[model samples]
Target: MELSVVTGCLAGAISQDPEDVIQGGDVLNKQASASMEGFLQANAPPETEVLGGPCEESSWIRPPVDFLKCNWDASIDGRSKKMGMGLVFRDSSGGFRAAAISNIPYITDPEIAESIAARWVVSMCAKLGFQSVVFERDALVVVNSLLSPSPCWRICGGIVEDTRRMLHQFNSWTVKHARRSANQVAYFLAKHALSLVQDIVWRGECPSFL
Candidate 1:
């Protein structure tokens, strides 16, 4: 907000060498402000408006910040009859932001596990009141179907549709594919759920490593 004010003032200035003035101590903040606004304005369409919070120009950035990492995963083991899901949200710095887990009895395929994980992600974003969300999954089939969704994939159809509906409430959100190596934290969170002997519900902390 302060940036917006200064940027406008600098752009209207009556001074010669405004760039030089900007480089000097008195108006460096104004230059930085204009530059940042320029950055914000670059990505948004000119027609967008701000009803609250940030204007569309600056809204693409999600906080819990760029240093924050957000992703999810599920474990599907058809032969072993185990299914589990997890979400791990962290600041880019790798600190634990938030984590959740669920164990389901419908253990017939890895597809089911992945679908449930996607559903959980949308639900979590809504529950957290996140205005901007970015979800990552390692499963290409799942991510592709989500981006250009299919009406099939019936194994978790109801949950999939529910997640899609929840997604419409956000101002900005993205879902994409990530490889296993890039998705290790969420992968491990789901893996940890499979390691547990007891069924558990998501609670406040990072639940035990079991």
Candidate 2:
């Protein structure tokens, strides 16, 4: 499929306000929503911790042979109500395959921002024709929502559902949560995107800053 078609699908999926959009296929009861909300509140890592300074103890891990790992992160600016998303794709040997950074309007909620980032990365991977991929991100809530069999009912529910649908296009895929330290490349890329007026993409080359 064309990249424009993928992007158009994403735009339609998330165009409505969260309260106004509930996917028919992934609908959950209010009780389920309440229970899940509490769990998210209790277990989700703090924003600062997820976006904190680098750590020497944790590092990026390579995927299995024949697979690609995509590490993704998001940076949000409260004043601008915009979010920057970064995605770095690496091969099983840990060689950089591609990277991209994008800036877009965002909801104030961090979970929503991360959800949008996940959707964007998935769409990008689909556009790149990646069949076997592992997605890693620093937002535990967003990761959990993707991994859950039940539909997410948070404000980012629609975005999460969209991401999940896109993931089905892959032959093999998994979504995992990683430490900020393990996601440094994408983290910094997201920060770098905050200064840009347009998206940037690198293929078969590393960014100079890295």
Candidate 3:
């Protein structure tokens, strides 16, 4: 908020440097006044208007009974042009079933990386013999594309087709999107891939970071 006010003031002034416009005393005084106002507003009676927190954070939800839930994520490093895909499988009761991290070389596009993560998770599920599963991801574009297959884009077409084939292999399967907050475990694993020289897999339980 202070930054917004300072920016607004700076926009109307001739000085382009923040140091010249953001006076210490003015900022301090304004901040104190704003804090007091916020405090009173929050502590005000129920009838009074006060700002409240944002909507509740999205959390991981368990899959249906007898089904497995797979949350996958991909991390791409721009500098090295490397991509890492991470996926964690959990039972309907939310117990960890398995997790894997794959570090791929020379992938710069985030969309393709996300698609690979999806395809990789499906392949993992097939090897694990999970007949019924739901694949969850934070990438809405990939999820939408998977739900509605199109031949318009040639990029990752083979990977997309491979994922479709794997999906059909399962008796019951689904692909859906979840907020990044709900997919923290997979995100952590994707970031963790950067430190590994080869793919890593964990069975029955996950690492301490989870």
Candidate 4:
């Protein structure tokens, strides 16, 4: 099913001509990993005030100067068997930079879906040549996996590996845990993605729903 779904997205790309818009694949992946490895590895943010987990800071936080913050979230519609992923990027001053929503029709596992969402936004930022980035997600599992230098061998291992590999492209990057409240925009965009037939990208400002 995964093969067929990927093949279909690939076939559809021929007409859409994604090549004229952005590039993809292992070459870019390797380049990103190599560049990222040249810098000191970053760790996840210190645990929030809540002690054992992320705090209920229901608000967005700005990244350091010269860095961009990209928040991502994922949702699954069990009835429709669709997974929606949303990403929003903002500059250090907290101004909206870009946002994207991708509807994936086959993902069922929540962890795997979150991993896919992380990879999607990371790849998007990489393609856009973003060097310093901070990725925030409500899924603590994903954040923890990214912080670990050792590879994981779970069902979602492949996606996790891809995500860690991509972090190498950034001169400096942070994978931190944010409460769902703080991730509202991306969460809404993710839920909205359930209705989209194809991926959507917005620049400078978010859609009216935001």
Instruction: Name the candidate that leads on TM-score.
Output: 4
The per-residue C-alpha lDDT of model 1 at residue 124 equals 66
Clashes of 2: 0
The model with the greater lDDT, 1 or 4, is 4
Model 4: what TM-score? 0.73
**Model 4, span 137-208: residue lDDT tens:** 877777788777787899889988887777776777777887777887777667655555456666664444
Q: Tens digits of per-residue lDDT for model 3 on 11-84? A: 11112111222222444334423533442354112332212112222789888898888888887666555666
Instruction: After superposing candidate 4 on the true structure, give the runs of residues whose Cα lies further than 4 Å from its correct spot.
Output: 1-57
On lDDT, the leading prediction is: 4
How should the candidates be ordered by lDDT, best one leading?
4, 2, 3, 1
| Deviation (Å) of 80 in candidate 2 | 2.3
Model 2 per-residue lDDT tens digits across residues 10-117: 221122222132222222223323432442354231221122221222678888798898988887766656666778899998898888777776554666677777
Off by over 4 Å in 1: 1-69, 78-80, 92-95, 153-155, 197-210
Give the root-mean-square deviation of each candidate in angstroms: 21.7, 16.0, 19.5, 12.1
Q: What is the TM-score of each candidate against the true structure?
A: 0.58, 0.71, 0.70, 0.73
Off by over 4 Å in 2: 1-57
Best of the two (2, 4) by TM-score: 4
Error of 4 at 9 (Å): 21
Whichever of 1 and 3 has more lDDT, that candidate is: 3
